[model samples]
Target: MARKKRIKIYSSNGKKALLLSPEEITIVKNDPSYEKNYEIEFNKGKQAFEVRNYYAIGFWKDLLFVLIGAFLSTIAIDYFISITGNAGLFPGGLGAIARFLSIIGANNITISASTLYFIVYFIMNIPLVIFGFIKIGWKFSTLTLIYSIISIFFDLILQNIPYINPNEFSLLIDYNLISSLPGAWGAIIWIFAFAIFGGMINGFSYSITYKGNASTGGSDWVTYYYSKKLNKDIGSLNIKINIFILFIVICLNTIILKTQHIDQTIKLSAIYNEYNSWNELINSDLGKALDPILSAEDKVSIDLFNSWKNLQTGNWNNEDWFNISKYISSSSEYDSYYTSTLVWKMKFKWIIGPSLFASLTLIITQGLTVNRLYPKNKILNLFISTNKINEVQQYLFSVGYTNNIFIWRTVASKKNAWNDQEQDLIMISMPLLYFNKIEDYLIKIDEDMIINIIGSKAVKGKNFSYTFDNELREKALTEEFMNNGKLMKKIESNTIIKTHKKMKKNGVSIQNEV
Candidate 1:
């Protein structure tokens, strides 16, 4: 048994070799990462490494953060998406796409929209999760999987707490103008309210998921992957993706509206399917007269009736649409034939009209909030003019600061200061949090120190960096305590260095490497 420790040498490319024992492999096969990364090939006789190494470093803490992230995401789906969706605002996201798809797929499947949303969302993530695991790392994809699974569970429970909808909304303070459409059929959309509140919740959900070292799955996997691969800001990439989704929604919206219009104008609409006597109604002068109830409201009769009726309905002119509108509007006046229809089409039907503005507002708000909330690769270039340079440097690149070795450079300006000749400008580039910690210390020492900080879009470290020996240390540490001591695990920070963002000849990076 003691001699069998080095038994299994599964796959070795020599340069990046991982030696895992058969017993260890059996244990790690149960790990989430094992199932995610190696399940396909593993079942086919291929072997996997100690995926447990990727975890067991403050596992509980990570789990708590991930659960909180999941809870936030669930709230966004159950409350924000649900309410905004009910209001019929095409708030673009994975959820919106899922909802629309569910509507189409619902007739064939015996399931609710919310449950179908979870399925569609899960299906959408499968490919991306694989990509994330292969390209990004195990921790990210594992956390993402955990987050999504937990979110789905939480959503199923929360979705049952029935929403209360009064179906009344006003665009502004005025009740008479720009209220509901021709009839109260289309609820007057509270565009600003929906966009702001829902956008905020949605944005926070995304941010919290990010903070937990995971994503909300779906497009998030691609977003994080491309953000790292291309070294673009996450918020900027999110805007582009969300805009594309919105564009698709707009196109789909137009197609649906056109189809509905055609059904109403040419192919007998469901409301008039029972009516067999079109000629009898035409001969009765029904097209000339208006419904008494519709006439009772002066706003509908004088203000919106004619103009709303004149809306572009494919090849039909103002006169044609007016005649058709009159024919349709007057049908409700006759109760003997049937309790007929006075149709109210979609409110703010044009996709590029008020809905576009609302969608844009929501996405823009979401993007800005993400950028502000959980900032990554955020570098701070500091030029501290102080006489106590030694004290400042001690506070900055000192050994006692963290467990990992500090690697930083300060370009000492030899020239004397204009006001204070004793002062020197020490140009250093570090992260935001590091700069924050060194703030009050510098202030306390040099009461008149002028510190100028320039921020970067996305940053990566230069030659001076701390790379944790993730593999070797992972094995030795886990073997040592058997999950007893808290290991100083590698910091898997996303430091994407691309284009001009790579540490320039002039740019210094006081960052870490994992």
Candidate 2:
């Protein structure tokens, strides 16, 4: 019988190699059969490399730009809205229609105007998503969905948070806090802060999504699509689309606000009618059932009213007149009316004041910028927290980038814990990849290991230990750790020599090796 041939199996992580059964070896290595097997492995390696470099790198870099740029832009936008009121800055074209509706009392016209606003917003946003699909391909549709969900969640949070009306809390401070300039300024600051924070979230989200070979499902797709269709650059297209939408949004908002005011007026009219009906019921004959039992003063007034009516029509000096005057003085009707009126006045302020402040603030916070707010000199106050760095790394990982390195900072040594003579040091280094770029490949730091790259012959690992902290732009292989360098080198050399001898024994040319 012929001797059995052994086969080898490789781990996906390239950590180890194992022996396969003789039959398996024959199926994999037999002339025509092996060719197919080799091709599959080569294709897998090529795909992995492409994803690692292009998609992964693109995500991390984009995220870095967003984190740095978005917040500032948001703050700037908020500031611009502050000095100017929403009335003028917001799109007023819709307001013009709402005004016409109020004058003619056509309810349906106002409703139509409001409905048009949502329709326009959706139409504008859809084009952007289509463009993104065209630019990056359908593989990134999930990105748009994720971003849409996030945007909705953020809007919901803002909506649910109750507005703080200063007039309601007037008893505590006993001041008119709502309409004052201070109150308006505080609201402006709040708007700026929220804008900055929200902008950061949106920007960072886009960066991460792209890194994952996806996009934030929206106008981004439209941008990409149009760029390709027009043969224009994608980045320029994106900028133009964003700016155009911003202009449209402002115009639309003004129109909506005006229409909203008209709607409020109609609502207020309905409320007034309801209140009047209830008031009439309170004065009816059966209204006595709702009132408390008459006290001494109320009974006196009732008796006077009956006595006065009984008096002659022209009698001006009768006992009934004296009784009526006394009874009026005895009643607390004046006090009751005064208290109710005061309460309504205060409540009105509580209702309207805060809204005005909020609107004013929103308008002002729309113009600040990142570079303007967070100048280079302000770095010391930034804290530069470790958590921030971790956040950045986590964002990178989420986008499918490998976490091969973790960068952090420590306190300078020699101040408190270390000796006076010793100085502290901070270190940053890149990790090495030791596998055959595809399968099992030794990665000893000192020993030379060959890396098998696609479309190229194997290359010996290059030393890169001292590359960092110098002018080195990229990491190489040789700086890796080796267990007994000399021994490893000898083992690798001998193994290769033995393999060559075996090949020669089989009458194969050594020159065709690898």
Whose lDDT is greatest here?
A: 1
Best by TM-score: 1
RMSD of each: 15.3, 19.5
TM-score against native, each model? 0.52, 0.30
* Candidate 2 lDDT for residue 96: 25
lDDT of 2 by residue, 124-242 (tens): 45655565545544434434443443433333333244552221222122222221232234533443443344344334434434434344434456554554354333554444454
Tens digit per residue, CA lDDT, model 1, 1-514: 5554523221222222224455643444443443333333322221123344335444456677788877765555544444443224455667557766765575478765556667777887788888988987777898888887777778676655544211132222222232222432223355555566667777787777776667877677777666555544465666677788876765565454422222122222332332233343333433224333333446354443543333322233445444444455333333233222322222123445444666777777776777787655467667677767677655543312322222234334445645424456777665564455347756887787788889866545444222122344444433443343222110000111111123323353322221
Clashing pairs in 1: none
| 10 residues in a row with least lDDT, candidate 1 | 488-497
